[model samples]
Target: MAQCASCYFVFCLYCRMVYHGVQPCRLRPGEQRAIRDEYLSATPAAKQAMEKRYGRRTLQLLVDESLTQDWMQENSKKCPHCAISIEKQDGCNKMTCWRCGTYFCWICLVALKASGNPYQHFSDPRSSCFNKLFEGAEELAEDDHEFRRVLVRALPHLSHRSRPRLCLA
Candidate 1:
């Protein structure tokens, strides 16, 4: 059988993320996590290996960044001068680099850290800036994004100057 598409899309029956030649899952939606979890526990060595290989935050980061692997996201080009893990705080297009504390405008992604809602339900500087920046590649859908909880789908909003698209914080 062809199997389910998501299985091939995300990972394999072994809980190992499928890099190539992966078949789809044969279970219901969201069943993979539980199955993968149980499967991991059943294998003591593999469970330890898996735990060493991943964690709650890192796994979520992988999901949030999506499998897309954008060049912009990989590097902190948001501030060419400072060049560190910078995040756009609320209030303006100014982004505060956590490492250097330098504020910059759209030249990269609008970062919404935890608690700072960039969307504001309407067009905000962060979202608007980002929307403008991503005006060209709006069609491209992010396969995944930073998922704190599967039940909640909150994402960081870009300022008006940014490519005008939602991006991982």
Candidate 2:
């Protein structure tokens, strides 16, 4: 339930509906620009609150990305997989997809895949670097979990720093 921070209305921008027990919309729109606007226009208290809630890097990106979607439900909300719309229930800046139990937002996953270092908070939060390759299904793994573990441990230190470093091949 992302309040407008001004009106404090608990509306789901993704679904364009008012909230019930759950938000009635699931979307795939990008909310980078709205995040940025909110950040750029935030009062100090709001900025502090957001930073306290989302972390510095997240706060920055919240003010950076300039894309949006209307029909896709996960937009305007934090969804790391770009595929599911679960309620944002934690202040830790992580969202889990009830559809697949996938953790992290699609932006972070895409950033990581694109060499954007979106997982810095991992070390601060005691999360393993191996989350890099710990993706869904054996298909993302292909042959062996052993290889995936190895890749997760080593990718953070690699110079390649792209999908190739995390690729099954």
Candidate 3:
């Protein structure tokens, strides 16, 4: 017979099962806390083990669901053109959809013309987004500078003849 150091639950050395003469083994405070914490942070494989041991499948499912919802709310935005969820890690308000290739603003979610200069939307005094490229940006001006560098690299591939004429109307 051996005793668990933390919980002091008696167990058989050969069988490695808890020894309960008549009543079930009572969980100690530390053991209960450890089980709760393990269930909360367990991966898929670990969660299986916890489910078998603690029978907390429902609780674990709820926890996973809540975590996923919180993550989506904070880190993702829906593309205005295709309605695809986009996760932007860094850069300016301008976003290009990978699925549909639609250019749009991440801040206002307005779709921009693919044949026109997207930068003009930022510089035009008549536009709502004029001079507000870095508005409400957490990274400050550094993000805008990096975005400009990326745009400059891409400009060489675009044909000048395909550029759309700005309509004053």
Worst 10 residues of 3 by lDDT: 160-169
lDDT of 1 by residue, 45-127 (tens): 76555444444334333333342235335533555455564433223444556676544454444443435553442245544
Residue by residue across 1-169, what tens digits does model 3's lDDT show? 6899999988855436787443333444445545556676879898786564445544444444454455567667888888988877566778899899988887778888789688677788998898877665777456556645654554454345432233322
Assess the local accuracy of residue 101 in candidate 3 as a C-alpha lDDT between 0 and 100: 91
Kindly provide the TM-score of model 3 when superposed on the true structure, using C-alpha atoms. 0.46
lDDT at residue 91 of model 3 (Cα atoms): 65
lDDT score for candidate 1 against the true structure: 0.42
List ranges where model 2 is wrong by over 4 Å: 1-29, 67-169
After superposing candidate 3, which stretches have Cα over 4 Å from the reference?
1-55, 136-169
TM-score of 1: 0.24
Off by over 4 Å in 1: 1-45, 48-78, 98-101, 107-169
Best by TM-score: 3
Clashing pairs for model 3 are none
